[model samples]
Target: MIKDELRRGIIHENPILVLALGLCPSLAVSTSLQNGFGMGMAATFVLACSNVIISSMRRIIPDKVRIPCFIVVIAAFVTMVQLIMKAYLPALDKQLGIFVPLIVVNCIILGRAEAFASKNSISKSLVDGIVIGLGFTFSLCILSIIREILGSNKLLGLKFFPGYEPMTIFILAPGGFFTIAFVMAVVRYLGNRRKGA
Candidate 1:
C-alpha cells in the first residue's frame, strides 16, 4: 500500500509534471540548480512537517474552519524554514527570495492537506508528503539542470563545456515554459505508450 502511494506521488500523480500544481516556484526558481534545489528542499520540509501536524490534528480541527487552520499550520512551518535558511544558508535564502514565504500559499501543500492528510493516517500522510515533495524536487532539478546547461553552459556553477556560448533565452521566463511543455510532451508520450502496451 505504501509502495503504491509512493509510486503515485513520484510518477503517476507527480504534483508538477502530472497534476500541474505549484508551477509558480517551479518556473521561477528553476533558472539555476542551486535555486531550484534550495527552494525544493524548503518546500519539502514544510510539506512533510505540515502533513504530520495536520494529520495529527485532523479530528480536533473544525471542518468549517479547517482551511484557515491548515494555513496557520503551514505558515508556521514555512516561517520556521525561512528563519533556518536565513540563519544557516543566507545565500540560498537570497536566491529563493519571496518564494520561500510563498510556500504557505502553494496549492500542492494545501491541496494535499485538504485532500489527503486530513483523511489519512499519520504515517500515510507523512509518506504522501515526502513522496510528493520528492516528485516536486525531482521536477525542479530536472528543469534547472536543462535550463542551467543551456542558458549558462554550466551545471551547479561548474563549467563543463568550455567555450560553449550559452543561450540567454533558456534562462528566462519563456525558457521555463518551453522546458515544461517539452517535459509534459515527453511524459504524455510515455503514458500513451504504456497505455497502448
Candidate 2:
C-alpha cells in the first residue's frame, strides 16, 4: 500500500507533470536550480503542514465552510513559510517573491485537502503531502536543469561550458511551455511503451 502511494505520487499522479496542479509557479520560478528547489521546498512544507491540519479537522469542518477553512489553514502555513524564508533564506525569498504566499491557493494543496487529506487518516495525509510535494520538487528540478543548462549555459549560476552561447528562449515562458509539453509527451510515451510490453 505504501509503495503504491509512493509510486503514484512520484509518477502516476505527479502534481505538476502528471496531474498538472501547479504550473504557474513552476514555470515562473524554475529558471534556476536554486529557485526551483526553493519554491518546491516552500510549497512542500506548506502542503505537508496543511494536510495534517485538514486531516485532523476533517470531522468537525462543516462541509459548507470547509473550503474557506482549508484556505485558512493553508494560508496560515504559507505565512509560516514566508516568515521562515524571510529570516533564513532571504535571497531565495526574494527570488520566489509572491509565489511563496501564493501557495495558499495552490490547487495541489486544496485538491489534496478535498480529495485525499480530508478523507484519509492523518498519517496517510501526511505521507501524501510529502510524497506529492517531492513529486512537485522533482518536476521543478527537471525544468530548472534543462532551462539553466541550455537557456543560460549555467547550472546553479556557474557556467558549465565556458563561452557557450545560451539559447535565451529556454529561460522564457515559451521555453517553459515547450519543455513541459515535451516532457509530458515523453512521459506519456514511456508509459504507453511500458503498458505495451
Candidate 3:
C-alpha cells in the first residue's frame, strides 16, 4: 500500500541516510537550511515529474536505450525547474549554482527511474517519487540543522547565542561526512532496537 511505501521511503530507504544516494548535493547544499530546502524541493520536482513521464512511457521505450530516455526525461524537468528558479528565486539559483544543473545525473532520480519507475505503474511510480523526494528533503533539512547550528551558531540567520564561537569545520567536506555518519549510526541503532523488541 501507499502508506507502507511512504514509511519505507522516510525510514527504511531514505535516499541519503539509508540508500546513500545523492550524497554530493546533500553535502554541498546542506550548510544552510535555506539551501538544503531549496535544493531538496528542486530535486523533488524533477524526480516526481520524471518518474510519472518515465512510467507512462516505459513500455514504448526500447529496453536497450531506456537509460538514455530516462535521462532525457529527467533533464527536461530539471531544466524547467532551473528556469523557474532563476525567474522567481534568483539568489537561491545563484547559490545552488552548478548543483542545480547537475541534478541531471543525480543517482536518486536516475536510480528510481531505473529501479522503480520503469517497472511500476504510473501511480505507484509517482507515489514513490513523492515519498522518496520527501525523504531526501527531510534528511537534508536535518543535516542542515546540525551544520548550521554548530558551524554558524545560528538558525535561519538568527543568532542562538551572542559571541559564541562557531565550529567552522561543520561547513567543510569532512564535517559533512562526520555529521552524516553520526546520524546514520543513530538511525541504525534505533532500527535495531525496534526490531529486537
Tell me each candidate's TM-score.
0.91, 0.92, 0.93
Runs off by more than 4 Å, candidate 3: 88-98
**lDDT (Cα, tens digit) per residue for candidate 1, span 1-197:** 87887788778989999999998878888999988887888788788889999999999999999999999989888888789889998887788767888788889999999999999999989998998998888889999999999999999999968899999899999999999999988998999999999
- lDDT of all predictions: 0.90, 0.88, 0.90
Q: What is the TM-score of candidate 1?
A: 0.91
CA displacement after TM-score superposition, residue 119 of candidate 1 (Å): 0.8
Instruction: Tell me the lDDT of candidate 2.
Output: 0.88
- Model 2 Cα lDDT, one tens digit per residue, 28-125: 88899988988888788888889999999999999999999998888887887789889998887788877887787678889999999989999989
Query: Where is the poorest 10-residue window by lDDT in model 3?
Result: 93-102
